[model samples]
Target chain A: MTETRLTEKTAGIRDVAARAGVSQTTVSHVLNATPHTRVSEETAARVRVAAEELGYRPNRLARGLRTQASEMIGLLTEEIATTPHAGRIILGAQEEASRHNLTLAIINSELNPDPEVPPVQVQAFLDRQVDGIIYATVYHDEIVAPENLSARPAVLIGARDSSGILPAVLPDERAGAVAVVEMLVARGHRRIAFAASAEDVPATRGRLGGYLEAMAAAGLPTEGLVAEGSSDARGGYTATNALLDAGPTALFCYNDRMAMGAYRAAGECGLSIPGDLSVVGFDDQAPIPESLFPPLTTVALPHYEMGAWAVDALYAVVSGSGERATSFAPTLLPCPLVERESVAAPRA
Target chain B: MTETRLTEKTAGIRDVAARAGVSQTTVSHVLNATPHTRVSEETAARVRVAAEELGYRPNRLARGLRTQASEMIGLLTEEIATTPHAGRIILGAQEEASRHNLTLAIINSELNPDPEVPPVQVQAFLDRQVDGIIYATVYHDEIVAPENLSARPAVLIGARDSSGILPAVLPDERAGAVAVVEMLVARGHRRIAFAASAEDVPATRGRLGGYLEAMAAAGLPTEGLVAEGSSDARGGYTATNALLDAGPTALFCYNDRMAMGAYRAAGECGLSIPGDLSVVGFDDQAPIPESLFPPLTTVALPHYEMGAWAVDALYAVVSGSGERATSFAPTLLPCPLVERESVAAPRA
Candidate 1:
């Protein structure tokens, strides 16, 4: 057994090689597990033992420079820092990247309509030689790919480009909305009010489509049930007020913020949640849903799942083996329903 | 002007050198703005123009390899991704790093009692040769420095180690609490009840200290005015119930969440916010404070500023200048008060 003293300086491969009584090439092959090396098992075992004893850490940057693969993935996001619930995407990607022994480098760009690639960020990532890139968004939207992004394997999370060139991973918003209505229907909500988001947003469109689809399937009239609003608390309040005129037993909101607004509206109308009215929300954003009077029953966007899948897809592309379909095949991960105290059957 | 057609391949430094009719060293010096390079201004301009014409992008990784400074800073955090408000730390760091032409790489570790540095993440950053590291916490707490972290320049954000060896940037919790009470006092509320947080947390201690200091300065009675809670909505509700018995006209909560609970408690007691009783909170965490009936008046954590400062401090350490004091000088950035609708003069 070799006694190693803790030192401020990190041990290098040369130290391991000298300690192991082996050549630097032998130490490299042993440490990297390089295939078809001429070194014997005994020599490899000695090298490993010496390396462990010396606490020798491999300089990955130097090795990556030679191999042109850093085992690092870049997560380039817009407004992720400011977005309420989008941080999970970075978490999901980070966890998955770690699982594959890959480091995820996150770069947040300013939220703007300009389509140009953030030159500094892209250049930094390129300089780092990140094996692949995951371009994620705070919301579901169409985007223009940064020029030369194709130089490295790339995938999109929560969004896609107009040309649909890169693969994407997104939450199944349509299915999520359908599930919300289906749950309400099961709870005996016949006259359901949909507090829809703005008409231009993709989530609003997808969720509204699902609301209409479910309404038709249940043989219920969709008219006067859908009220449009900006995806916010004030919008929910206004939409719920209008929907209340038609009298809805249940209100399905665009997102949790709007649902919070719905709660305020219900209070204004002298109604109690899950007593006089049952409410459902989407995106299940935290601190909002969980902190509500009676925690909100809402759809949890597949943020973590989408994030994990984005890395997996990017990895597949980087490895040059997996189903890296060139065409725009936006993979939709399921949005699971989080059952809280908000949902209840209609009044007797 | 020479018109260059876009090509699939990225134009290399070699291409720029050839186009500009300059040596590779001259091209490198001109592109990198390397100091002390004797290249004529005319030649530098010619090189820049040629490089721009060919869309030449310098490989930063290659340059960093020789320099041993990647201009990358690692942000190792625990639960920043899951935490509701901590993502701003990353944004602030990213923005600051960008201002210096550096890249911020984020790594989130699982929240656990064990304070071991995430080995894989540390290794990855080491491999990437990040010039420095900023170790940030989701919430303010004491932490253990990762082993041998001193090998590179590092700073702590929102936290500190037992040894206090590293430079730390933290929100001024004590001052924040003092400010909260001062705001209530300025509003002409004499009877202020403090819904305090748990006894053990550092924030609770710091904030309570501030409360006492402010109350002493105001010559207000400190006894029977402080009610301790678990720093949640339920805790706030419970504490408010006890404090209300004291017949206080205003309540100061440990956090926005507790303030929310105070609202419910106030409602149950037939009181309206700022109408019957005024309320103030700390850590103006979003959704809770803002979404309240009247937005809660609270102190905003200097998360963005702390993050930006951490990077600056780390940069100073990296640059080997600025007071990188060895002794623990925990830099407490000011927590500014954010006024909203929740505060008003106590009813006569």
Candidate 2:
């Protein structure tokens, strides 16, 4: 009620400056929260009150034209709904953009409709004159950056630009798989089995490769234990059922969906999770992990971290500040393992 | 690449007009793809080719200042990452926005911190001079519209504004529940049990209320049939276990997570789905419904529809065109049933 009454109409910067006994420049600096501006706390508070009392609403559009900064970042993400948890990436980017007082303008693209650069999508952002652009995708390991993307400072998430022009960030899928294996090995499970995905996506190779490297490092043989299946529950079920014939006491799935199948397989075989046959999965995806019977232990992709990192990197280039990473290898954010009740020492 | 060299530097609209042998207004109409323009296809093609040839990028910021249309809408969403498949909502809105040639500026807010309107967040959008604002929340049935939100055209998604001023759209939760029961009854399950969530969210009441109303209308007696548990898998498991003692032939869970638990309970009781027990769930949430061994028969909230609707509604109001719905009750989109493998007729 008070807010409705207090907020009537706009009072220009001049009104705020005159009311607060400050220059219009000071009012703009204080209201915009301009960096490197030294305004006393006492004066800033007075300016805010005066502005509020006068119903002063700063017009960023007018300011943007004068300053040549739209203060908007465009995010073009691919196949958002199908991905396990793309929302976290968006959430991370949106929040970090908010922290920097920049608005995130988002566009959803079809899942890599073709190998060609999405010049039309990039052009849309350029038309709006977004200060920077962030291209996010889960399907690709390397992408051809859109030609017009170079028109502004840009960043990539979940995929690297093949040309090595834009700074990029992605989850360390190999490292996460290694961590999962090391944890299981520490629990004394030498007969660990891997349920690999049939899909040829980058994640499949990264995860399987990590498993092989980690098993080798632990001086354990994976002969006849690494089975391939579709990267979902049914695949997990079939792979686990097949691997069970080898009498492995533990199973590691390519993803949480596959782990769901492993659990079902265990149930059918009269095995209790972490008791008779311990199981673990990757992509500690929401609802899947926590909703499972014993809450399956899994590795979490650094989706949120990557999203946040992209914005920070883009902002750095936008403002021409902050330590900008050289474009070479994409920054690999850690995919940490989340422990739940699904993993335990294999039954003696 | 041809695209890089072709997109080298900017060419003013005047240059495109001169090259295309058309006026600047004709070039603008064709390039902006302004609705209802009468420019012939040949002329439109020529203008586009000229603009492409000269690399003319339209300055939306300068155009916005002159025309007072930012061509942007701000979407303020609450607890985006935690919601079940909020990305679908985003995808729907974004795709629709793209169709209208409008950019969707998004900001994710923490789950409502208080009943007090989030003036600061609203102010941020207002600062950017977004032509309209869309406030989306899953936690509330109705909310107080922020004070300055009235400064521009606004719409609500997932919740209604209490003041009955701003137009809103929400999923038909109660109707969705009714559909589930009717489907079960059609499958010959008279003794259908409901695994209700213990949480106090509006979804709980909306779903449960639909069940009770539908049951009563079907002339089915509500004996010891409804069981309550937490809104997740564990809750579904415990509730399903207890309800099984009642010898119900079918179980309808509050959501898919609970259905997961129901699946577990059926396994423990040695009951084969359809032959001994049939199960159904709401929120045909990704991976959950499809990943289940027999898959799941569930209801899908019109998340995508509502998202698209909000943008269309906002656009209608922004342009002062289209059948602008009068502010009153919230528009309810349908929740359709997605049939997988879990549901079937009970055995004789």
Best by DockQ: 2
CAPRI band of model 1?
Answer: medium
Residue B11 Cα positional deviation in candidate 1, in Å, after optimal superposition: 3.5
Q: After superposition, how far is residue A217 of candidate 2 from its true place, in Å?
A: 0.7
Global CA lDDT of candidate 1, please?
0.82
In model 2, which runs have C-alpha deviations exceeding 4 angstroms?
A1-9, A17-52, A115-118, A323-325, B1-9, B14-50, B323-327
Chain A TM-score compared with the true chain A, each model in order:
0.93, 0.91
Worst 10 residues of 1 chain A by lDDT: A1-10
How far out, in Å, is residue A194 in model 1? 1.7
- Displacement of residue A261 (Cα, Å) in model 2 is 0.4
Q: Which residue pairs clash in candidate 2?
A: none
